[model samples]
Target: MNVAAIETVPLFEYLEFEFLLEYDVFAPCDRGRTRVHEPPELFQGFLHCYYEDVYGTRPVTRELQKPLVWFSCGFDRPPSRDAVDRFLTDLEHVVDDVFDHLVE
Candidate 1:
């Protein structure tokens, strides 16, 4: 957990994430040891991008340093732009499902 993110987690600590965890959001993907971001965390990260008007991995990485976004992603530590690219790319096929799931 990042210190900056930890400082402000209480605001969302009570938030329920059970809904997002109900399904294996990444079941369609071939993720193995490289799975870093989970569904709940990705949902939170997507919300951050939606509100922040930041799109794409590079853009998301720029905003990832923000305390709220950092907390949303549940990141253990700030990741590099390349790492973000890889993570998002790995989950790219499910991006549509992610948005659809959100609307339902």
Candidate 2:
């Protein structure tokens, strides 16, 4: 994820405070010795990526927003290195396109 993009807006602006707090509290315990690590900042980027993937340019209606929040909070399991690598590699392109749309 691009630091410049991330710094432009606070992550909590997009995510609920309770959700971020819960993850901050539990992530260490839940991810006991996982080789594929995701920092909180990177995870925020993933959430944004997933959100854009699902919602496209449409306004995030309440019905559509709930599932994205649920999915982001519930996806706590550690993925395999191969899976993480693959997803992140693909995510770069997705994020680029998302940013392109945002700029336009």
Using TM-score, give the best candidate's number: 1
Give the lowest summed-lDDT range of ten residues in model 1.
3-12
TM-scores, all candidates, are 0.55, 0.29
State the lDDT of candidate 2 residue by residue for 1-104, as single tens digits. 34333331455455432333233322444547543434443345345545455332232222223433424433344334453444355445455544554356
lDDT of 2 at 53: 59
Clashing pairs in 1: none
Instruction: Estimate, for each residue in 1-104, the C-alpha lDDT of model 1 and write its tens digit.
Output: 45454333453465544464445544435645554555556555655665657898778878877755675568766566766676576457666765676567
Cα-based lDDT at residue 30, candidate 1: 63
Candidate 2 residue pairs that clash: none
Q: Runs in model 1 with CA error above 4 Å?
A: 1-32
Residue 68 lDDT (model 1): 53
